[model samples]
Target: MSTIASLSRSWSSRVPAKRRDPRCAEPIDVREKRYGYFPKMFVHRGHRYEVYAVERCWTVSRRGRRDRIERHCFRVRCLEGTFELYQDVRHNTWHLQRQVD
Candidate 1:
């Protein structure tokens, strides 16, 4: 094997992999800011998480329909860890998208 390839493999092996669940669509209850609709806290599976900071926020539009928003996604940081949460615009319900820890 090439020297660079071996070094890259070694580096990757030493770093811990991030666990992610892309299909975690479980429903959640979220409390958001009154005006801008930013998530401040959420409850999932009987556990409550208070969002300390919003890392990222974006809207997912429907395929072939740019004007229509399907969901509002937020990557937030809480006391336990970072998590991806989203709100389904059509149903007006919240969901825990994934855990990034």
Candidate 2:
């Protein structure tokens, strides 16, 4: 590998391929802020995670078998650390997309 590639490989953490088991859609209490739906807290795995802040937000869509799946993605910080959450409109289920390393 090149020098830059080697440096990045050693420095950066890799995204995992295996997904974790999906917890049931947690009850996210949101409030309308200046921009949009701001999540305040959510209960998952019997633990209540209070959102310290929403670091970023974005949207994504992809073609599914029946229709397009649109989702709202959020990068949020809580007591633990940063985590990515997705609200899949097609299924009306919120998913914990991934946890930042």
Candidate 3:
């Protein structure tokens, strides 16, 4: 999230971008904490990351060719490291955006 985006007064006004990671859509198994909204485990690139903690989460949207695209992004900590994962709510897809550590 950009500084200005992070400072949004309300969740409805927040603007979100995919940060520095290259965009790729890959299928993964996710263990959900609640209604599959919160991630408890993440698997990608043949490596399974157990999400020990979810630091933060939010949703952002952008205009798409077909419809308004919404993404659910989670900043989480796992056995390996901290990472940002964003899920496309409209398409039911997930992207591994970047690693914080």
Clashes of each: 0, 0, 0
As a TM-score, model 3 comes out at: 0.69
Give the candidate number with the greatest lDDT.
1
Off by over 4 Å in 1: 1-23, 32-36, 64-69
TM-score, every prediction: 0.69, 0.67, 0.69
Instruction: Output the better candidate (1/3) by TM-score.
Output: 3
Clashing pairs in 1: none
Q: Per-residue CA lDDT of candidate 2, range 18-91, in tens?
A: 34343433444343233446566766666677888889999888887988879888899988988788777776
Candidate 2: regions farther than 4 A off: 1-13, 19-36
Question: Which lDDT value does model 1 have at 1?
Answer: 100
In model 3, the Cα lDDT at residue 95 comes to 76
Positional deviation of residue 37's Cα in model 1 after best superposition, in angstroms: 0.7
Instruction: Residues 1-101, candidate 3: write the lDDT tens digits.
Output: 78777676455444344352246445666755555478887778888888878899998888879889898888999888998888888878777877778
lDDT of 1 by residue, 5-97 (tens): 999999878754532334547899885553568888788888988898999999987764545658999899999999888888988988887
User: What value does the lDDT take at residue 12 in candidate 1?
Assistant: 79
Candidate 2 clash pair list: none
